[model samples]
Target chain A: MQVPAPFDYKRASTLAEAIALLRECGPDSRVIAGGHSLLPMMKLRLARPEVLIDINHLSELDYIKVDGNTLKIGAMVRHVTLQKSHLAAEYYPIFAEAEEQIADPLVRNRGTVGGSLCQADPAEDLSAVFSALKADILIAGSYGTRKLPISEFHTGPYTTALNPDEILTEIDVPLRSNTGSAYEKVERRVGDWAIAAVGTMVRVDDGLISEAGIGLTAVRADHFRAKEAEDSLLGRSPSTEAIAEAASLAARHCNPFADQRGPEDYKRHLVEELAKRALSRALNRSLPEVH
Target chain B: MRVNMSVNGVEVSDEIEPRLLLVHFLRENLRLTGTHWGCDTSNCGTCTVLMDGMPVKSCTVLAAMASGSQITTVEGLGANGELDPVQQGFIEMHGLQCGFCTSGMMLSARWLLDHNPNPSEKEIREAISGQICRCTGYENIVRSIKWAAAHSQNSGVQQGVEA
Candidate 1:
């Protein structure tokens, strides 16, 4: 039977209390929201934190709303909420799409967006989706709150830029008009981690691509994004040829490792194919049909 | 730590270790073995139970985190010694062969039918996709959930008999 090693558990009633607990528990402590990712790791002895501060009772950090031109999502928002949120689907379809593919419904009910992003698994879907949207993450520490671009959030696999005493509070996604996004993933089975997944967002203006964002997962795209591909799509029409070129650039840039999921070359192929499919769908949504 | 929670509508309190999983808390501590534990990882949904009316894999949840929540196991599905519609439907449709996955499947079906009275075949399949039945009796399971959806309004007093 798999079980976590004995540790002290602390439940924080408020955000301030949670922060204080984190500081008091010191560096060997960790904050748990959903505990889906953390508990499993604990069982395997992969993550042996001396103290676990449960933040589920902090209802203040569970929300999805619009503030001016930005869509703000609280860190404690569960994956099920994101998947079922009509507002999320309307503004960022990639979130709903990716949330649907994250684990299963049972897991989604308890798994929080904050935990997923903080876990920083290379195969995690939300990281790619947020990376494509160029979202900013809000972190709170004893000192104060700080915002970090999603690109700089992940320092490495299973790691984040968050300090030991800090907690990620919210995600800020800049809303854009005439923008459409889509996520495409290829998993071996239902609820499995992606072999390779791509999330694409496009902003079309006057029949030209004003801006584009391409994010890849599992295939290990640098910073979870394809900067060269995104740059190539800028100022270009969303034609099949232009999209193919950008997709090729995206495939060439990612560094996938060979594993039980697939070989490195197969993952590279999936990156190219999924990127093309995601870009096509995103462009279709951004531009009105001529016919 | 001292944990207090409602299980099957009964208020219970106990002193438990922080590392104790909810599945163990239910099975060993509370002696509610109806909620089966399978594939300690969250992949298999056999350990599923209703927490605040939503289905959650109990194996992945710490008992400490569920201290104040209301949990409904398969044993709580029926009241006054009557079977829940889901339990009756499982018998009527032969939803189980080995019956290892029956409890979790029935609880999930009950939650789904409560939220969506009439789910399509695809929806029912999707609802139980997290559960793994080695007997490969998913067709009967789908039919069982559909049967429950149809008979949900009826008072389910009939005794459940395996087919």
Candidate 2:
């Protein structure tokens, strides 16, 4: 067994303290919320920080609140909570469906949404879902706080745009519009990491496509929008041919890697199939009259 | 750090490293070895234990974070040197050949029954998907969970198995 390197451990009772510690420790201290991703990386020697500042004890950061126009989820909210939340099921049911398909119940119970995003494993399922949902990440720093769109937050594989002195505090997702969203994934086996996953959110107005956002995961270095596919569907009533064409375009945009799961070309093919299926489902549910 | 939590109905307060996983705290510090550690990667639920009545992989949970929480290991279920109904059901159903994954299977089953009393086969399969038992091929373990869920409560001390 590979043990983690020796590190200083600190507990923060408040978000202010956590941010302050991040500023003070700079590059050495890592904020640990659930440790579902970071701890495993630490054990594998992929990450070896000088300090582990635990934010799990900060009870103030564990809540799921539905404000007037947005649903705000604290950074420490576990994936299981999001999966089982009635609010998520009512407002953002697609996220619930995606959460249900994550690693498994044990990882879901301990993994936090913010940590998953911050870890920025490009192939992360929830990251793509949130990116397609137009979620905002609330980050706290020594200066104050700032929010960034999920699209702009994740920079690359295992990297985020967050400054070393910044810590993510909450994830704010907008309430659904006259829209329907769907998440579809292709994995090597049940309960295994996804080879490629697609999350499509479509907003329809009077049998016409008003807006569309498509996010792809595991097929690229980072979760990215399939703007070409979205562009193809805009202002048109989606048909089988159009959806298939858009999916093919999405396939062309992916940068999949040949891994133990599948070949890069196969992963690209999966993205196309998954994107087509997900977009069609979203279109059907969002614009039933047109379908 | 000084940590305080209840394990197996006993309140424990001890000093521990913040990076120490709850499984190590329970097994090494508290000397509760019933909770096995199969894969520390959190892939296998062998280190599963009930934290605040919810089943979680102890290897992923920090001992410091578990402070002030209520934990129940596999040892907490039995009574008077006997096996719990779930444990006995595994024995009766031949759920184990090597017995390495028994504790995780039992705790997972216990948590499943607590949330869902009469689970469908799909739900049962989903509940224990986190646990991996290479010994029994999981057929008998599923059957054992079903049997324990069906017969244990309604039987009311019918001389089948005592816990």
Candidate 3:
């Protein structure tokens, strides 16, 4: 009985073709690739467009390549691909870890990195990983392509800066040498959305933290970098006391609501637990010889 | 929409509604009832199938998206009438009770073995984490996958190591 809303379907061979279709369909079109996120929404009647622009066949967009000092993940790269790619595991371990943790294996085989971001769900695991990695998202629209920092992409819960005509092209994650990153999530059950999630990336130089970034999800409108917590840990060793205090600061800064997953108190507790665990794991992996 | 694809090793094409799901196409159009539709949502892997040798949730994929791809359903799993090794393992290990989740479970296990071949117990669990089965408690299912993984590795499939 599950069926998508009636819509004309078209397969686009290239970005230009896709954009042309989008432009032609105007506001009644929706682009779907690896519909782990979008298809379910459509079946649930939450999203019903008159045209479905199928872009999964655009094989050019399904790639993971090293470009200079950053790793470029194609927008169509499925979650399963990210989880299994050795390139991703080496360069962006946190993202790979988080990608593996998203949904189940079946969904991963069909869900995509771009769809997760474009969906802009506050509880999505990959969104927090993108924020913590400070990745750049490439957007291709009818006009031209533009890059936006991950932090600026998601403006609110279920909302993004992407225009209706624009399609997410790729994600660029910087290759951090001698850095450790970890993604820890607290969910109601395995393969479920995170009730509250934390992504921690730390670069430790000679036992001292050099650069640090923290991303939180499900506690705010969208995944956001915890600037206050990052500031507190930037120049310090990840001592248990220091990490605890930093995590507390993160918990304080987040504005979480009482959702079906848990209440605000429980969610705040999850932040502390996840933040502490993620920071410690990242720090442990950041040792010069860990790689 | 008109879709033409190889389903269960058979070349077929049919006129379908634009909203028809790949699961429905396989079940209703091809009459491959072995592919059961469990939870229509992407959460349950009851209608899992291999699209170009990769396992995908059939419930979530539109039939229109599968115009040129190769689809392998549970009915296409075994060679001839013999049970596939993964299916055999499930039977020997008593992996199913009610059997509602069997097709998806077997397909997921095949995907895991074809890719990993020798997965650890944790990996086996994680591989089929998307599949939900309320019967047989999953202990036997995980055991069956682990059993098949060990035997499949010995059967000559290469196990790629993760760095």
Which candidate comes out best when scored by DockQ?
1
What tens digits encode model 3's per-residue C-alpha lDDT throughout A1-291?
877778898889998899999999998899999887778888889989899999998888999999899899999998888988998888667977787678877788788889889999888888888888889999999999999999889988778999889999999988877788999987777778889989998888777888888999889833577788888997787699889988998888898999788899998898988999999889888885654
Instruction: Kindly report which residue stretches of model 3 are placed more than 4 angstroms away from their true locations once superposed.
Output: A205-208, A221-223, B146-163
Q: What residue runs in model 2 are displaced by over 4 Å at the alpha carbon? A: A221-223, A288-291, B80-82, B154-163
Question: Which residue pairs in model 1 clash with each other?
Answer: none
Encode model 1's per-residue lDDT on A28-116: one tens digit a residue. 99999999999999999999999999999989999999999999999999999999999888898998888888899999999999999
TM-score of chain A of each: 0.98, 0.94, 0.95
DockQ of each: 0.80, 0.53, 0.78
- Output the worst ten-in-a-row residue range by lDDT, candidate 2 chain A: A221-230
| The TM-score obtained for chain B of candidate 1 when compared with the true chain B | 0.93
Assess each prediction's global lDDT (C-alpha) against the native.
0.93, 0.84, 0.86
Candidate 2 lDDT, A103-185, residue by residue in tens: 88877887898898899887788888887787899998888889999889988888998888888888998876678888998
Q: How well does candidate 3 score on lDDT at residue A279?
A: 91
Question: Could you arrange the candidates by lDDT from highest to lowest?
Answer: 1, 3, 2
**Model 1, stretches more than 4 Å misplaced?**
A289-291, B154-163
Q: For model 1, state the Cα shift of residue B115 in Å.
A: 0.4
Q: Which candidate gets the maximum TM-score versus the true structure? A: 1
